[model samples]
Target: MAEKAPKEMSFLDHLEELRWLLVRSTIAILVLASLSFFISDFIFEKILFGPKDPNFITYRFFCSISQSFGLEDVEICDAKMPFIIQNTSMGGQVSFLIWTCITAGFIIGFPYILWEVWKFISPALYAKEKKYAGAFVIVSSLLFFLGVLFGYFIITPLSVYFFGSFNASPEIVNEFNLESYTSMIKTSTIACGLLFELPIIIYFLTKMGLVSASFLRKYRKYALVIVLIVAAIITPPDVISQIIVTIPIMALYEISILISAVVGKKELMESTSK
Candidate 1:
């Protein structure tokens, strides 16, 4: 009997498909970003700069908790931050606007971007795998946005409080540049968002047989240490701040282990059936 030729797609066909995906994703990002630009003032004032104020919701919540515990020395009880933000560059405002729009675009377009990525990889997966598209997108996007919120509401504030209040001498004052402050917020938010996709990454790796539950379990302790180190890097030096940041990440790691085990079982079942 004659051997059947392997199915193949032309290079140009692949390129055309990829081009449309990019075009659609870019359009979605721009539309969302344009909407975000209209609310940029609110985003900056109410959300971005909220951590800098003592009366902010997070600060108020922490203050109430402290009062309930009878802790009189809580840092959240401070009247105001002692720092001033300034812009020194000539085109700093314009540059800031452009980058801020792009950042907003990425955040809003994250789901669509994931969809495009899924489409690219879906051709290589089995029918059973394709069924997970919606769950993967929804769960991954939720985790990412949750991470961004945690970074903004918790990690950023703690770091700002620690670094802003730190001084070598009583006479020294802290004056931060607007660009620098915004950069810190943006980096922290996006970094955490990406970090929270660990379980999804592990799921795919497990599906591909590149990783297993045993491997993850064996290295679990090391992962915990790394998570704590990362938390320390992103948060204030205080143990409370580090613990708060590490908890969710530890939870995510445990979830990743469960996901890997599920994937491993599914692969085993499929193989046995074949």
Candidate 2:
């Protein structure tokens, strides 16, 4: 039996395909987020607000590290976050829950979302590249999750402790809104997750001839300034916390440089052979 000809996809056809991909990704996120409704108590009391407590694991670890270095009275160990999380609006609590669940859903469903995105882009790749679909999803997901953990465990804790406790004066007390608190967590986690995709982004940009390793190297100093600025922005105004956040990001940038170099090498080899 003869097979029918494959229909050539137009611009609108591609847009339609993207729309379906987004729908599937959204469903995946919502479904996973919905499951958190069963564990709302744990999510709010323990996981979401874990960084606010002095006894959180990140605090304890930093305390031990500080003590080991002979630094007296580590802030993380002794400091109590002197702030109250209150709801200002009538639906503030309800809205917070919804947003929290949605954020959690996106983070949890990240891998599935990556799968959908890869499906959309896979047709553009060569057969050899297509074989890397599994690796791409796994590595990208792992990096994202790692970034999320880093933000939650390190950056969030430090920021929470610093801002929650810091008083400009003895008169001004910190009364944090519920929405504001969740925004900090959501922004840090999501931002870090996206930032950690630097290497992957660089690899593809190199492949597409949009960027090269030389370009990255040329602007390494500028990237350093930008990284430091980002670290300072997301983290507390302390040198230590900023340094901790900056290290991983700088490492990712370096790794991106290496990835770009390898991709360029591969493309050059392929071209030379032809």
Candidate 3:
């Protein structure tokens, strides 16, 4: 006997399901955030402020690279970040702690959130596709975390180094607000995480017949320009930093094109067989 397909849901039912999904995801995030409060000091000191240190891992790695190539005069090999982070308002510290925990929670609970999203959409999938739920969640979560690490290690350090060292005049000292500093860190990590989803996004778009490998190839130049623009937006104004950011993103775009091609090929074969 064959298994029956899932019954179609009405609009109201779909909305109700989506509402519960949000509720569950929110609860998970809050729980994780609450747990994070216990380790707030560690997060602030080690994770958030790590990039600000001259001896940070990223800085050391780049310094080694510069030394290995005999580029002894590179600023990263010797310069220090000169900016200080200050909270301007009485409630600022309290607010920053709360938001930072929430951000941490979201990052930690990303897999659960993806699972909830998978559940919300699974009813519409065929049984074969539904069986791949574990793979979907795992792959998406892996990609997201990779993106986060890339942003934290590569983008954050470069931005901090560049902006902190830049001076219009020797008289002007760099004192970044606490909010501004944390915001930069958060934006860099989250943006890169989402940006790293390009291949997955292409897979879905190809499945829905909305995008094609040829389309991506045809617009390769435009995509490069867009990638450069996005890199510039995320990194500092320096050419080297911008180039560093652009490299991985362009690689992701190229991978997306390949993913789209593979998906299209599979769909074509399936269609012909049917």
TM-score for candidate 2, please give it.
Answer: 0.92
Q: Candidate 2: which pairs clash?
A: none
* lDDT per residue (tens digit) for residues 152-220 in model 1: 887788667767777889998999988999999899888889989999999889978899999989999
Give the alpha-carbon lDDT of every model. 0.81, 0.85, 0.89
After superposition, candidate 2 runs with Cα above 4 Å error: 1-8, 230-240
Candidate 2, 215-258: lDDT as tens digits: 99999999889978877875554466678778888899899999
Instruction: Tell me each candidate's RMSD, in Å, in order.
Output: 3.5, 3.4, 2.3
Residue 22, model 3: Cα distance from true site in angstroms: 0.7
The candidate that wins on lDDT is 3
TM-score for each candidate, following the candidate numbering: 0.87, 0.92, 0.92
Clashing pairs in 3: none
* Candidate 3 per-residue C-alpha lDDT over 1-274 given as tens digits, one digit per residue, 9 for 90 to 100: 2233559899999999999999999999999999999999999999999999999998887767667767677777775888899999999999999999999999999999999999988887777888899999999999999999999999888888878888999999999999999999999999899889889899989999999999999999998998788777655544665677788888999999999999999889888877
Segments of candidate 3 deviating more than 4 angstroms: 1-4, 229-244
lDDT at residue 217 of model 2 (Cα atoms): 93
